[model samples]
Target: MTTLKKTGARLGTLPLAVMVLLAAGCGTQQAGDTVKAYRRSYPTPSTPADFLCPGEDPEPTAATAAATAPSATVPPTDHYAENHGFRVPIPLHGQNRCDGLTVTERVKSALEPLRKRGDFAPQHVQNVLTDLGYPAGKVYQDGPTGVGFLIVIDASPWCVEGTMSRDSTKADAFGGYPDGTGCEPPQGGH
Candidate 1:
């Protein structure tokens, strides 16, 4: 079609004309300036992540040091989680927003006292939730990212979860898991 040919021709040349105008707008050293602008806009991965935040302990934890100790009786345990009780499986619920806010507030109140502990750590979260009448089997615990549990306090579909940062902590309720139970995200990678 004549119209299609006209449109295709415009599309091909439009970009070239715009590029020429843009380069002309550059005051001097057009190619170098464009290259520098592009480089600044799209930074390359010049350095690998160290994973250590500033002011954090550059040294590893005591457990890690013990694992590498020259006097170790055996190699470090491969099933590190067997003794730690890290991932406690729980019933999961799918996403729902109906009762999230109310159940979330309950979770917040329950965590208030524990949060007051000057020495609060992730490990304490599971025990505290269990003491608050949440079903022990229904409470799930993961590593430093705090714990998650179903809102069994009332008829609600929400999972109360907590998270911590170097400077602060937070708790909120989210819609249940993918399979539709109010527990930690399915398969449990925080």
Candidate 2:
């Protein structure tokens, strides 16, 4: 068959334009839609408290401080425990608040979840210390990277009081880890 010459039809750009328009339309979301989508994506975290950034010092709030403060009469258990990822060490001053039995048991319990979480192993060096025994009068505080607390054994000269800072209530200053770098404890005059 002979070819029909001379029809020079122009190609339509409509298909390409439609694709661009569809992309532009879907690119941005409305503010409410964004919020809705965020909620859907994140859901609610299991423990909001656990996720809170251990702000500057990571000290417990006043109420918790009071509860943790050692009293003249030691409780049967002076133990301290937490789900061990890295913990703000119990300050040297706060050491008195923990009864050996309580401290040890609490440490065991605290480490249980951490063990489950696969954080520091229950058999790690720190865990071993607690397992063997914590010196009765020693002090401890978080290590430099602040990943873990360092334990001061036997109330040595290296021993110093935990840093003290004002309480919002003006109830009196409370003890805490001094800010520091490395394995050294925060320096505070006892």
Candidate 3:
């Protein structure tokens, strides 16, 4: 009776071990299938054959050189000055005119009153210029540099000029002054 009981216990443990082994084999097969499916869904990316390494200079082709060449049809104009990196003001008048007063005088009259106030807003200066018949744009506030409020005016020919800095007491104008030299300001205050 003791021998039979020991054999029965061993037989029960053998079936459990076989079931665990079969489950492990099934799990391995599922994992392998999942890996195969993922690989099929997303293929590996390929590098371009003509890719250049860092600091490698490529030889310019004839087509690229021709495309970069300057065109002869374009006439040389003072467009560079007009479209400078800094924002420029728009002209009050459609074209350059020497009518009432010069741009300098107009700007001075507009800004002096505001400057006397001792630290007025930039909008106030812009309004003064607009009210004085000179439309102002690109108003910049001086940050840490103590440069003050800088205003730009599209005053051509008569002044081809604008203000560089406008503080609490004064405003500084730049571009051709006194005689309006170094300016071709008839077409859009260039």
Q: By how many angstroms RMSD does model 2 differ from the true structure?
A: 17.2
- Index of the highest-lDDT prediction: 1
TM-score, prediction 1 = 0.33
Evaluate residue 142 in candidate 1 and report its C-alpha lDDT on the 0 to 100 scale: 38
> Residue by residue across 129-188, what tens digits does model 1's lDDT show?
666666543444434534444434445544566543333445555434444444544454
Runs of candidate 1 with Cα error greater than 4 angstroms are: 1-98, 137-155, 164-166, 179-182, 187-190
TM-score of each candidate? 0.33, 0.25, 0.30
Model 2, backbone clash pairs (residues 3+ apart or across chains), number: 7
Q: What digit string (tens of lDDT, one per residue) describes model 2 on residues 1-190?
A: 1232322221245666788897777746765997898899997843112222212136678986564454423333424422221223333232332333234344445445443544442135355446656432332333321123334444322221221112110111122333432234344332
Candidate 3 yields a Cα-based lDDT of 0.47
Ranking by TM-score: 1, 3, 2
Candidate 1 versus truth, CA RMSD in Å, comes to 15.5
What lDDT score is found at residue 172 in candidate 2? 16
Error at 126, model 3, angstroms: 0.5
User: Measured by TM-score, how close is model 2 to the native structure?
Assistant: 0.25
